[model samples]
Target: MTEEIIIAGFGGQGVLSMGKILAYSGVMQNKEVSWMPSYGPEMRGGTANVTVILSDERISSPILNSFDTAIILNQQSLDKFEKAVKPGGLLIYDPNGITKLPSRKDINIYSIAAADEAGKLGLSKIFNMIVLGGFLKLKPLVQPEFIHKGLEKSLPARHHKLIPDNEKAIEIGKGLIQAVQVLN
Candidate 1:
């Protein structure tokens, strides 16, 4: 089956990068994928969004009227896209950012405190990677190893050293989900 995921946040939160990494993982797994980014005039400080589609078969279109999954990194994003997810779709949000919980019972919503985890790692920028980790853990759409390798390849050669740290961020994100699952 194909999955369409949207990642959104204010600029500089790595919203686009999060979608790219997930799409790259799909490529590594031999899936057809597309990464489409939405940018506003202000670019960095403005609202940013990305749509990532991964399919076992050829992907027809890059535009997603609705999504099978969504990761919201800010309150505005959550309010804007939370209703766009398909019925019974999955939605993941950063608890640090979202002030209101989703009211739809048909959609599965997860509130993860990824910013706190990234802060503990001394890197607030890695919050996006943490959200990606939760996506992998809960959805099983792509392998973590594949995602890590894709991230390494997608980064600039000059910044290759950051791959290991990114992988660590992903791990911590997965750990958070696992901990919550255990609690439940």
Candidate 2:
């Protein structure tokens, strides 16, 4: 199966890092993976986006013309990518940062207050991990164990102490998103 996911947000929101984590997890799960990030003129404070591809077989192209899923961390990102997601695709957004959403009926949208949850959890800087959690729960591209293991390897050795917190964030994100699904 081939799954293309786009993670977009303002600069310094850890969009690229989120893509890296997904790519690394795909590797751990024995899947083909590629992550391509674009900064363009938005590196300062503008928009940043990363496309992450995961497949069961060899990947021909890393670039995606259309994405099957998108995680938007800000309203600008939501506006930029809301129209680009493939039909029947999934779009996960941080409702705390993105106040509006496109009126698309073809795509499924999952809104989570990631930044606010991160702030409440005292891990505001690791909001990307929270988003990753939502992605993992919504998309079965890779297993949760693989993601946890990837997180262990993604961070530097000196930062081993942060792994537990990151793992906690992932679990919290998954739980919150899962609850939303259950409620629906």
Candidate 3:
């Protein structure tokens, strides 16, 4: 199976890191993976996005015009990538930053209140992992064990102390996601 995904948000929101962790997870599962990130000059407050592809077979290219899944953390990303999702694909977003809800009939849309839940759980840094958890709940393309291993591979040793918290954040995210819209 091949899943082409786009994770987009403002910089400092862990958009790139989320994609990296997902790519590493795919690798840990013996899947072919690719990750590509894009960010503006403003960096910390600027727009950031990443494209990740995980496949059981060899991947031909990292560039894509459309995706099987779009993980949007902010309204800007939703505006930019909303139409880029393939028909019958998945579109997951955090409603915290979205001013306009997505209106699409062909795709399954889900809302993961990552920011709100993270704040409630006092897990601000691992917000992306929570959203990743929500995505995994619906997709399950990669195993949770692989994600844990991927976290180990993606995080620096000094930050490894927070792995348990991040794991908890993921679980929280899994339970927080709600189906906003479903295609019939």
Q: Could you estimate the TM-score for every candidate?
A: 0.91, 0.91, 0.95
Shift in Å, residue 100, candidate 3: 1.0
Model 3, clash count? Answer: 0
* Candidate 1 residue spans exceeding 4 A from truth: 178-184
lDDT of each: 0.82, 0.82, 0.91
- Model 1, 115-164: lDDT tens digits are 88888868787888888888888888888779877887688889888888
lDDT by residue (1-184, candidate 2, tens digit) is 9998889888999999888888998899999998888957877778888989999888887787788998888888878888889998888888775555556777787877788889887899888888888888887677878887777777788987888888778777887663223121
RMSD vs true structure, all candidates: 3.0, 2.8, 1.8
| lDDT (tens digit, per residue) of candidate 3 on 1-184 | 9999999989999999999989998999999999988855856688899999999899988989999999999888999999999999999999996888899988899999999888887888899999999999998988889988998999999999988888888888889899985334
Off by over 4 Å in 2: 178-184
Question: Clashes in model 2: which pairs?
Answer: none
**TM-score of structure candidate 1:** 0.91
Off by over 4 Å in 3: 40-44, 182-184
Predicted structure 1: lDDT: 0.82
Q: Candidate 3 vs. truth: CA RMSD?
A: 1.8
Which candidate order results from sorting by lDDT in descending order? Answer: 3, 1, 2
